[model samples]
Target: MRFPCPDLDPPYYAVIFTSRRTPGDGGYDAMGERMEALAREQPGYLGIESVRAADGHGITVSYWRDLESIRAWRQHEEHRAAQARGRADWYEAYEVRVCRVEREHGFDRQRA
Candidate 1:
């Protein structure tokens, strides 16, 4: 998706998901879109950014209002199912990192 969500305001949480795909799409693209849509419907979901390289490595960092929000999203039934499918069908390997964003700053020349 986009590189990053704008003006996240700090004191939030980010779930960083890094992975390597197995091979082909194998329905992963559709499910990924579905999960993203579902995440947007969650109570504390801020936004999500994702990208992939030609070598099959990818990263998706999802912003949330708090740890509780992140936990809820993780245990969401559909999201849990997607995680299962990712392990069984889509991803060769993956890692998830959760961090508190205490502060943030950036530049956007395009906005200037």
Candidate 2:
């Protein structure tokens, strides 16, 4: 899915990952796709957005059903390994923010 954000209010968790990517590597693309696929298979994974900028900085925000789900994702072995690779190879710098989304709203237009 391109985006996975929802328009509901019942308390959800958001994992905001901001990163500056390293130069010349295909590893990040593979790992990112793997993570997205893996996340969909995990319970409580609502959705995610992987956004990048022209200067190599980007943000990936993933929504979850609860804090427990976020924690489980954090402790996932494959995720941990990917995190390590991110630090060692893919990312020049990165920061993660975990927050509670108490409210949300959005709209979409469809052409007939």
Which candidate achieves the best TM-score against the true structure? 1
Count clashes in each candidate, considering only residues at least 3 apart in sequence or on different chains: 0, 0
Q: Candidate 2 on 26-71: residue-level lDDT in tens?
A: 6878888999999988998988887788789998999899988999
* Cα lDDT of model 1 by residue, 1-112, tens digit: 5786878978999999999999899999999989989999999999989999989999999999999999999999999999999999999999999999999988899987
Pairs with steric clashes in candidate 2: none
Q: In angstroms, how far off is 59's CA in candidate 2? A: 0.7
The candidate that wins on lDDT is 1
Candidate 2: what lDDT? 0.86
State in Å the error of residue 3, model 1: 1.7
